[model samples]
Target: MLFQVGGQGTRPTFFEMAAAQQLPASLRAALTYSIGVLALRRPFLHKVLDYEDEFFALLMMILEGHSLRTTDASFSESLYGLRRRAVKIAVNKDNTQMDSGDRLRLSGLEKHQKVLSVAFLVVLPYFKSKLHSIYNKQREAALQATLWGNDDASFGDVDYFDGGETSVARRGLLDPEASNWTRIRKRIEAIIGVCYPWLHAGNEGMTFAYQLLYLLDATGFYSPGLHALGIHVCRATEQELMDTSSRIARIRSRERERLRGPPWLKALQRVLLSCIYTTLDYAQTGLIAAVFFFKMMEWWYQSAEERMSAPTVYPPPPPPPPPKVAKEGIPLPPDRTICPLCSQKRANPSVVVVSGFVFCYTCIFKYISQYKRCPVTLIPATVDQIRRLFHDM
Candidate 1:
């Protein structure tokens, strides 16, 4: 949808496009199938592709070694203009000659400028932020659905609208459970590929191209930086998952070249990518992390309680007769513009129903994702519990 919004023909399927490029029909069909399958699993590809300028800059840096520097330094700081983006207009005010208010009113030019200014400055950003939030929630929901067998739950499953048998039956090593029919198809393709050199390159090239893009974070700036960093860590930790006796690992270790760079570089990556990046990426594992942390905390508390011979859930919350409650009600309600937690004007107001507290959405969510507690109340909270507070005009 985002890609469509960017412009039509933005997502030209590889089938017809490859054919036009003079690729063999078979290869074209294969690539189209593969990409179509990829789209179904990862629908956000459109948004990623929508921000083409950033990717183009990165590509030029990699391929051409230099790129033009523009005001749009990063994708997050998206530029606004009349071309494609919303246009900006400045409202002029002059009290000198006949004035411009009440009876005098704004001039036709001023009125149009004000409307355009509000649309570009306010409407553009607010809508984009909401869209981004929705995209992130979709991802978090998909992850939870996978881990907790909640595919049947409201979270929904990874869906593909269309795909060929080859793409669906096998996503190569990414899907180890290739059906028997898919295996037969692979064998047939391999035999034909041997006869036609272009077929071999064409088929392999499609997957390789997609993999390369995925590795380089093709949608780099649009996504959270930590996700790309975590992936690099996983790539470095490849050998961690291999069994000592695994045939492939043994073969590679025995005969292949392995470069051990500097000890310092290795240590740096361990701390930077493995530790920090991986922890931030764990925010996606919303439910899983919550369950895991409490389980560990419970075990520790039980051990401590056993030693002390105390009977309780574990260590209690804060020592309290609890904060004293006022018997009388306040004269006025809390400030709507200011966040209770931050004691500042809210930018993106969100509410914590359990604690009856309001805060900036990002501030509260990041804190909750990290500590799983409301900052003010120290009460348990989850990302799902944060409700966006909207005002109707």
Candidate 2:
């Protein structure tokens, strides 16, 4: 009998097969006697019987060679080699299992250590560099703001061309309750609502950073202390509260610009100015305007008072009835199409029009289960109509 590892066709060596099988009493007795005699003649075989030691030594030699080849390589490259060897040995030993408990070969352990070391050396430094750059950019914005303030810089002077200087008192049209800055800030804050949380969650810090920069550009102001606080909060915590704070700050900056324009005009500008707004509002307001308008038709179901108060009405009157059809000149049909539901041959069969097509009563009822309206013109058909047709049938 032959023993094969993992049932592969390859047979085990003679010693492995001997170890696997339970020998008969006579054969076991003979084997014990033969082993004692062989042990006395070849004592060195017993000393060299450590299989694990030999395996480890071979693995170490291969690892040392690989280390030399990857001495100056990147963290990803080192990790790649380590993961590749680990997965291979793991598959070979554990038969395609990728569980954590699988015993890693000696080379795999050594590779893992090297990969961890490289990750620390490479990833940490790169992250530090990025952090430093962000810090410097914020500092520069603060310094610019300070310099501009010191120079007493103001928005360009508005020249009124009316030019009748007869002690004409000009009242500034500023509304403290809803200043342009406040309105803009509110709108921006609303928009930044999504972005702020993501940044705080650590899922999108880069995006938040860009948005902050955009805020600075739009508002022409900067608070280094606030920005620093935000950065610290974002980096130090992963909780929802911290994320909310970051989002609030981002939104505030955005809204500061929004207040400058009328709400409708601001919405329109947002629609026309950026592809982001276009992507967000497309289905609800753009090409699908008819659907949205229909959905927003609360006026259709309003109370009498509400209807009277409404500013506009729809489907304005026709421009004089189509010159009254002359009944005498028109020829009569041989017979009206039979109403399938009522079983009465009438002039007009009370056609159930839907999606530009007509269907008989029973056919329409069956179709209504799958569709809401007429198949031909997409007009809504009443259940009464369906029931009436069925009763007539």
Candidate 3:
């Protein structure tokens, strides 16, 4: 059966679970883009962006660690009215499928489960990103080596993206042309080339399968990470969600009753406490609204034709006519095959469409680019008007 909001201890519906899962990733992507934009203005932010995976991972570690410790939910899960619980299987001594033989208990996760989950959420992704980057570097180096075929290929010239050489072994291996390092690098790259795709595919395939199974109600865990840690997300009861707020209000009420401060100070403190509580209560809802608003704006911009339509472009003005008196350029060579500019036999001949005169490709291109006119006829022209000619020598 599908779970509804406010249902205590009930498993959330697939939509809710999916929303919770997607929310964090969407927020992260938006944050990353924002950081990239800011980095353009702040040069040092570029360096920070280089280790963005680790930087964001550290932030997630703190946020998720705090959420898990206090509410047994990650920030996104909590925002979606869900909380994680440990799953324990129960079986009778005979190990039979009797009425009381097979049962499952849902409770708070153990200390180790929380720690491991935090690591999986924060550390694993950073390492995965780093590995993928390394693989790309190795693949590029391999391609460069192939292209440099038998030309003193410098297999070690490729720079590792993460702060140069990571170990002592790579310290002086930059000149591997004279040693067997090139062969070793080739063998290692060959192994990575063979294994990376399979590993990447398996990871993606397993994640998809797990999500599918969860959506079909065939699995308790929505992700492989959760399954490995025996964690299940369930809807938080209304009372549980309201407990902290009520506790805070009660404490504040007692303090108000015993207040010895001036009336204005007491009132100020009360207002501040109320504001803090209100902000905390509504912050998640506000964030969800903002994200949805941004997404709607993005969709509208992509699909709306009325907004910022391409401007019509007029054709460029024609180049000015040549002067008639002294002839704008030097006289053309009498021989048709000789270039007026280079004074040599025309090679890779090209014609200036505006002037109807042919010249060597290099000579005409340089002349039109600099002078913007035909060398022989002195007619105004542009490099764009030059056309290459291909025919039998």
Candidate 4:
């Protein structure tokens, strides 16, 4: 976590905080003043995109991720409302079964927001690199054009392929690429995102959710996204989801299973986390101002009391340990069979992390290698997701 300053990670060295990925201001709703202040002020918060290696950070992500799941769910509901509006704009008041499929697909896409988020996160840096290369070339061309007194020719006039020869495409994730393949890839990603939702839906959405939640500032995170989803959910009628496969019911059931605590408890945790986030926001914005204001207040109090004593406000109680783990380490619907693969008692129990479902260790490891998807969800996955589960009888 870089080196801590008085237990704060605001300023760590380059090597120490090496893996921490800094995100853009645009993602956090940069327009809002509240968000702006928080962004400007948080000196110690490294805005970590991935800190899975650190145990405390991992624990924090798990706690934060679930609390965020509630926030995300609320936000998803809001987004649907907006989508319904757009749909109405095209075909006003068309209540066909195909429309129901549209609602279901939209709902599914909203649920898989984290998966899309990861796609964007992975794409953006490469996109930036490509843009930078394009910009540099354009600048160099502009310079040459000006030097030759051909000022009429602009950077936009710069040719991509010199000597009219086709440039060979580069490969790999980081390579600067703009081609038909990118469009094809996006379409495929969209299909998977809507149909299957997150890669880790069972565990507080996907791994991407953690990054998004962390990237999203607490104060500014809620309103816009939630407003959009709320509209979609509110606009869709019971008949909208009722016409076909009962998709809403399935989605709701999955959500209930995903939540680690009771709904109310989970909501409370999010509320508290939001409050803490707000406090952090405040700290970030008026840090120096707060110190000066406190100094003046302390002086005034000292003068009034005719003494040199400092104020004696008791420190708040230590926060309760995060209720991250379940009471039994077993999922709810408690009496169910421990292994889904064999549908039997716990024998070599393991977890398929892609779907967050337990199975026989060997069964899942072998199954994932062959199928490359979670058996329960039928979602694409890899063998790396199979991990042993340790639960005492």
* Candidate of highest lDDT: 3
Worst 10-residue lDDT window for candidate 3 reads 1-10
* Error at 270, model 1, angstroms: 99
lDDT of 3 by residue, 37-88 (tens): 7888898988778878877787678677766766788868877768788998
Task: List the candidate numbers ranked by TM-score, top first.
Answer: 3, 4, 1, 2
Q: Candidate 4's residue-wise lDDT over 1-393, tens digit each?
A: 011212122222222211222212221222222333455667333343122123223332433233223323122222221112111222324554345334311332343554333233334334443444445555565577677754433345443325222333333334555556766765654454443323224333533453354344322122233233332212333344343235434644575455567789978866775576555334323433443455565578779786546567798999665333234343333545666565567677777765667777777787788988777667678877777767775
Best by TM-score: 3
* TM-score between candidate 3 and the true structure: 0.57
lDDT of 3: 0.75
Q: Write one digit per residue (lDDT tens) for candidate 2, span 44-142.
A: 545433232343233323333333223322211221221112112244454566666554341222454444433333343344444444455545655
Quote each prediction's TM-score.
0.16, 0.15, 0.57, 0.20
The regions of model 4 sitting more than 4 angstroms off are 1-68, 73-113, 121-137, 144-393
Supply the global lDDT for candidate 2. 0.38
- Ranked by TM-score, the better of candidates 2 and 4 is 4
Task: In candidate 3, list every pair of residues with a backbone clash.
Answer: none
Worst 10 residues of 4 by lDDT: 78-87
